[model samples]
Target: MWSGEESSRLYALRRFVDVYPTITKPDRHVRFNEKMWTTTFVLIIYFAMTNVMLFGLSGQALDLFSGFRSIMAGASGTIMHLGIGPIVTGSIIMQLFAGAKI
Candidate 1:
């Protein structure tokens, strides 16, 4: 059992998190064409990024996590190589720490 009060140690962080900028939810319904266009644009950008290799990376550079590439949805030696992994990892770590009250 715990009270809802913020811990003194985390009071500053809580305030900072609250004031952080974030994308606001749309107020009105989005049109189908708008949604399709947005999806198509994003897909095109993603494909383009996947094809663009990292600058100065050797052609023979070995990928240690080649087996997990499909699962991670990332390209080897590209800018998006660690896409979503760090974000998801941080989220999970925060969740675990919060659950343990650490």
Candidate 2:
């Protein structure tokens, strides 16, 4: 039998990924988008240097990016990792409808 906390956690996770396909584009890039810019080499070096700094700065940035790694799989995984929670997703639906004045 599942504990109360476990059941709620499962339900909460399910709700966060519950979004419709909006009329707008969901994302513009994938991971390792080195081709998106003309300055690929420069961006590579910049990313590398940032990694060096992040590795030396107690690694909080790395931890954050590790959370974002799920986004590489696309939006469902992204929402799951974010744990944006149930009420927030419901609120966003209301927000979009309000914006549309519907």
Q: Which number leads on TM-score? A: 1
* CA lDDT, candidate 1, residue 20: 89
Model 2 per-residue lDDT tens digits across residues 4-101: 77666566676556673447654776445555664777667544533333223442333555545455432222333344466698899999999999
Worst 10 residues of 1 by lDDT: 1-10
lDDT of 1 by residue, 2-94 (tens): 555653566657768877899998999999999999999999888877778878998589888787778757688876675778789999999
lDDT of 2: 0.53
At residue 100, candidate 1 shows an lDDT of 100
Residue 14 deviation, candidate 2, in Å?
40
Question: Local distance difference test, per candidate?
Answer: 0.81, 0.53
